[model samples]
Target: MKLPCLSIIVLAHLLLGPLSVNALGATLDSSVTSLHHGSCDINNGETNCTNIIPSPAKLHSGHSSHGMPILNMTDLEPQQRLFWEQYDTTTYWSIANDHKVMLYLHTFSLIISVMALYPISIMLSITKSPFYIPVLTTHLIVMLFSLLAFFIYEPSTPAYLYPNNAYTKMSIILFFVTIVHYVAAIVKSLSEWVIAAGTHDIVFDDDNSDTIHSISSAHDDLDIDNLEPVTGQPFETKYQNQLMANIMANKWVNSTVCSFGYLSTLVFSLFNPLLFIYHVIFVFTGVAWSFRIGMGNQVFNVLAHFIKGGVFFLFGLLTWARFIGAWADKGWAWNLNPNDETQSDEEDIGNDYEGTKIKINKKLTMEFIECFLIFFYGSTNIFMEHMANTNGAWSVKDLQHASIAFMFLGGGLAGLLCESQVVSRFLPNKKHAISFNPFGAFVIFWTGILMSQHEQEIPTSTIIHSQWGNLLATAAVFRLFTYTLLYLKPPTNAEPTRPFTEAIVSFCLIAGGLVFIQSNTETVLGMVYRGIDGMFTLNVTVGATALLMSWQFVVFAIKGWSERS
Candidate 1:
């Protein structure tokens, strides 16, 4: 049953052929001469140079002094080969800047990473964590660098891998979709948090109760429903005090943006039905589940926030949504029941640092499905890449299908295992189950690293840069070491080692960014200034920002510890 050596060789050739084709696209060796046979033809660098007389066209004693070799035209196969052989590389369409496309894709990917941070930021802010602003700002800056990277690099992706027009359009549209969603979410959350904290003086329009500013506080006793309009007090201009009011006054801005998003989704769905549908599903589900984890309240209120808040934007839409929904649910108010004697329940007053009581219901089931889908989508691509390295055990296309199926299973497991009851079985404390919430991100990050390592056909130097897996793997080992150190220490109320553990997370992230910047430094810097990697170059920009952010997080934790001491 042994296959012939020729058959095996043919199979290998077919399988490895694409990698070779991709290699043909490596950075051009500028030192090489562009002329064919050191002679110019009448076409002067046309793709097809028909009359290719030997270089110098020196006569060799023959009937035809020109000595031009002619091939028989009767054989169609050979004719095609001759036609291709005459083609000159000089006329090939090239990217304005070779690494521009890579920069664009990388930037957009970083933006997506930033989008992922909103949920965590919202959670921390609600609980009034001191690190809220810093954490959120770090992610925002990371996203900014991502966007800058693309433009700085000028997104000149290899044309063969991606059709310029289609890829460009898709990337731009997707970036906006994510941007709008985050902005809306932020607005809604900010407004809600403001009213909840009761740190601001809310202003209201006298005649139009609904039109007056701000939302119901998380404390149910506030009785926003019965608030009386203030008659004649100067409106305070302190940013925090009137934050909600200002946002609520311009509710239509977010509404218009969301409406536009809906329209765009509808239109794009026509051409890219699967992509459009998947993205919508991801956003909807991601918001719902993340809201549940971050905000922690009744289903109805979450829905209201989602509606009022821009579907996804920075915190803006979220601020607006919460403000508008509160205003609509309960008109203009000035702390109606500030005198209530009863203590506020956890549900009524959201707790930032602790978990909220979540009911297991149909909505919860949907959320689980959504979480799985998002993870599955991210992992499938990387999984297929590794599977492709198996030497004909599976075709790339088939491996893609297999990856999807496997992700479906893995995602479901992730959803199930994340449940409190399920996690409590293995962990020392049930309360810490929520900490595993970031497991999805961990999975996605590693998948990205693996994809880069398995990626085929790039130049050796490029591959070295792309292989951030090595860095990440080392980080993982270090993380395990930190966790062991934390475990050995006696459990205390403050969890003294908490800061050090968090530093590990920051370190891993910084390491990932460092490797990425290192690998793409040349191409990224080339886009801005020829050859030189300046102090403010792409890699330097990304690396510096990452280092500063991680350092801030680490220092914040250490500072907190010192203050306590």
Candidate 2:
């Protein structure tokens, strides 16, 4: 009975607690309602009584919640309203300024022109053909035009005026380099004229009648296998003496007017070999400068796109060059066994001799270079990504990118170790000329997947990322295919295989790099505001890449034709 009573009391309190509280609250609410009704009633018609009732306070004039100004378009002047309208809806137009457009066109034209000229000049120079000087002159003229355009039309914007900016410094350096090159070209031409006059004078000289006869006699009497017993002179002494006599007899060679010309010619001739390299750098710098101006404040983003995209772009080009036998002399034309040679009769004669076989230095192949570059890029990118953070603290985004760098570092390091001689000794196929390392391809594939899945706040950016990501992934896949097919039917000779899959790989990489650059935030926004979609941008990238590849093939063809001639 006692336990039941205790349980009953607890159940009553739990069931009626809310009802009892509600009853008391309702009584208080009625009393307050009655008091309010007495103070303000429609029957009394008392306006003062209504004012006594409490109410919420209204917002202050010209201000909204959180003390923000309430912008009223009607209150703004015509000019101010127009400015606001343009600012809100015309961001894209403002960003794509006239100066940027001019720079873009200039850079594009300059790059295309240089691309065609660089290979042509190289071929002409190597063959010492009659057209070499003219082609080189044309190249210099083009550079001069580009420099003039840059100096004359480049906007004097604050960003470009910044003294410490990299692009500004590059422009300054380019100015000096172009001037020096122009002067060198002038000196070289003058020197050539002097040398030509001297040669013409020496060749047609009738006074030196015995010169030709003596040279012919000495040349005919010279025996390569026998030396002069009494004179004990070098084999070419007679020829050298005759040649010197003819040179000294020439008035042009002996004149003081031609001395400086000859010296200048000799000095400039040393740099002539590096002209192609200089031209390439000149064009690339202009392009980079244009990119910097167009991208605005995102320096790191610009660098990321420029460097990574440039590497892949170059990789594709090199692959294509390799396919066309650019480096066949170095045994780097994808040959399986470049060092293996057929046993000739002379070699066979020494086969039984243990010490007869000569060992040659190991050749550095393309795959090894790829692995080394991948490692180097990864190692440096680790610090680079961290340093990109302005606050010196790693955010989630920084870590995310840094993780990719780590992956590259590991993959590249492993490839290097495997390709190393010490590590190769433990492998089964140690004697193979190529190590057949797939880590580089694998790293590219992983990066593609990660980039493809990378989320961006803007839908346009996301789509662009996916476009390049797919291309990169496709390129990696085809690269792997190339490796597999080559391994199965390895080419024995040091000739370009020109595998079909390699072409696909080249196209993919080139296209992927181009698309990667287009995915920049500002670029995407500009395109978006101009009603350009991802598909249009992708099509443009593809078309440009194809055009570039076609141009590259033409360059290689010209090189091949020159070599044959």
Candidate 3:
């Protein structure tokens, strides 16, 4: 159906005067007086700021505005959530599969890309001998499937359509595959570290017998049961060395694939994945930290690490449940019948405060170490982006800023602690670090969005709009051509192409498109005024440039196919 267009008078009245558009903390179009996005309220010169657009009068500090609710996007809409899942399967899947040629090609490309980074400065400190072989291989496999997905996947349904059949399961499977490769690698590596550290300790120790005796003695005091050696090899020189190598190879993958459930929940389950991440961290920190202590009766010597791990993990889980329930679902962790409020007098003594003051100090210590090591040191040698910026390839909106910004905080830590491997060895205690940082993501998400939005703004003109307008369009076309050329180029590249070529081509296409589209508008304005077109003639050449860039994926994919053939 055709929508009504407001006349000039109505538009002037409704638009609330010309203001620049800004969202998520970035400004767009300093020259344009009005913003397309309602959220971009006018600031002195900023496009996006915390309180700029959200006027105090319109939305009280704690209240929401008449503007779109963030939750309404998908969080509050059950059908919309379902639609996204089905869309991943029935739509993006099919299209990607259909383009299997490009899918595999890029997948292979990603493998090469990952491997290529090995010699890069980042990979040096991971291990003396590139410890990320499993990760590299897994990355390759993921790329392969990504290619299969890109080419072989079909889009039989409309945008964001939820499906109910076998396709949903298939989509879920594909989703899990990605998570399995990633999380499993981490677990394997950590596990290998445990093995290596253990065996190596025995190999190098002057008092293996004494150390082992001490540990056993401690265990006996705690009444711990014997753990059958899973290494299955006598601790002999020859066998132990061979086993060490095998274990190290096994090191990069974790034993439990519960993390696999992560992607499943992401693609199929209806809950927020943030909850899952917290739970996983809690469990990992809890169980792992427990090993640092032994089953002992003494307070100072007891398995404080394990106790700490347990408390932190458990409390975090409990806190999450309570937070989500009381705030989100308005329910308790345990359900009590609404009709059954009567309590026995004897059982009611201080019942309201049973677990309230229970603190997990031990767990908190372990969790702090866990977060510090994993988030900071462990990930430094790899992608600095904690969360992948998926949209970075196309638009300004694709970053998880907080997770990433914190990554820098992590990297700074990484620079100092690259080689140490002393590790935890036990049931955990739940303590301080056990609780989830519920609002941590909000901190990162909004900040990243703000930074990206700021970056995307069309700034005050350094060059005349008319000059750069067409140039932006032209740059977009060049981007398409260059990317297409890269695809056509053989896979045996000596190195990844330099950024300058890509940059030049993309901007030229963008400028060219802007100029071409706006030229028509300019000419029309000129005729109306009986003078040269100066104002209201949005030279739309950039429009075409942008459109072509938007469609450049088609060219890149086609070139991929041609090269493969």
Candidate 4:
């Protein structure tokens, strides 16, 4: 089905490319020389200009997600023009076009992720189906990773500050990931079915019913006490059984789960090469979020992080500069409250700080906060996903819902197929069950979504008669509402965590070992065992004092010379 569909696509492109020259941006009427901004070289009025198509940024005018984009391919510097010309043509789109493509792609990926999968049936039925496991697992990992930036982390604390195409890009990646996973599952299952048809003797000792009956085959009338039978190899002779052993030995063990060369190729699909390629674009766009995914690129990673640090520092300086200007004009600091309205739409009420000489260094504060949010969004989501996939006892429906009494399922059936313990014993993927904690990962995604969707107190919204208090209050309310829902309700439809910061928090953390120790506390006579603190307040002295007394008692009373003897 896919092959035929793809064939049509290829045929259509080839047949249409030449006929749609104008549609393809090869407008010949405009003299190509006018395109390049460099000194237009005019020779006898025949201006020499490059006939290259303009980037969306160069062609487009007005407000874009990435500020006012300068649209015109010819306006690019000579080096940039050369760079783009050498770029691969297989898939080439400027920022605006890319965003459109992303919208389509992500929808598809999400659909793919929703379906339930049959790992056991797939492993048993497919012929040469080894490739599916690795492909599926890699697609799952990278798509999930990429989503961290677009929907969740970036939305909450934008590194580049929004209107950029990151969210759109993220949606597209996830959409494709879903499509790839679904298509791969179909292929894998069919292949497995083919393999199983030709292959024989996959069953183990349990397959031999003759042995199953023989142990119980003692005549029904035989007394239970006298029914003891020979337990060694059930075959009448060893010669017959050796043949069975040979068939079993030749069978593919690892291949039973995934096909050859699957894991290695799948690993490269998104982050490594895919995200690395984006570094070039990020450089031109001046964004930092892209750097988080491409950390494996050591040289680029360091360069990007440093560049981000400088951008943040410069922003801080600009904010300070604003304060200095205000102080010079009014002999005091600006205020948070808007000048004319009771409820200003600005995130920071510059008017509210009227009498104050200096601001709280919002530039530094926002920088630190944004940076922390980025690390936090990425790290915690990764951590939570790892935990769920590894430990949570996920069921098939948990793949789609919050079905369990306490825990919720994550990664859907895909997770179970790739990483669950029992399924992995029979149906393995790249990393096995070790790193897969689907519920935790889903929580990470959910958390990112909530944060990303919640708007922050940026200055621009306030510039146009917007109330600072209103903006702040709105953001705060939205934050509190979403967070409360996340905390109170378990992510029933694909498990999600309480929030990013819940784990580090402790209101009533009941340690598993702490309660057990309480029972033993009364057993000792002289030992002073201070009970666990009821509040978050410091019981530092009491805790230390109790521990010291316990240690003294143990050392003097429990460790005597007779013990060694």
The segments of candidate 3 whose C-alpha lies over 4 angstroms from its true place after superposition are 1-28, 34-104, 107-357, 362-565
- Give the alpha carbon lDDT tens digit for every residue of 1-565 in model 4: 1222223223223211111111122211121323444433436523344643332112222121223211222344442233233322221111233244443343233223221112221222132233334444554654554443335433344333223444356456545645554444443343343243343223332343433111122224222222223456334223323432333332253233235324423533333333322422332222222212111212232233233333322222222322222222221122221121232223342323333322222111222333333344344333232222223444332332232111212323343333334674675333210021333334323432332233212212112112212222232333344345433432222112224322211110111111111111111100111111212111221233234223322322322321222
Write one digit per residue (lDDT tens) for candidate 3, span 492-537. 2112233334445443433432222222211121121221222322
Reference-based lDDT, each prediction: 0.35, 0.54, 0.29, 0.28
Maximum-lDDT candidate: 2
Q: Give the CA lDDT, 0 to 100, for residue 308 in model 3.
A: 26
Comparison by lDDT, 3 against 4, better one: 3
Q: Which numbered prediction scores highest in TM-score against the true structure? A: 2
The regions of model 2 sitting more than 4 angstroms off are: 1-109, 126-128, 155-165, 175-297, 336-361
Ranking by TM-score: 2, 1, 4, 3
The positional error of residue 267 in candidate 4, measured at the CA in angstroms, is 18
lDDT of 2 by residue, 127-202 (tens): 5444555676676676666655565555534443223445545556655665555455445554454343333332
Q: Candidate 4 — which residues are off by over 4 angstroms?
A: 1-38, 42-111, 114-209, 213-477, 480-565
lDDT of 1 by residue, 425-487 (tens): 787542320122434444434544554555322233234335444544444454455435433
How does residue 537 of candidate 3 score in lDDT?
Answer: 24
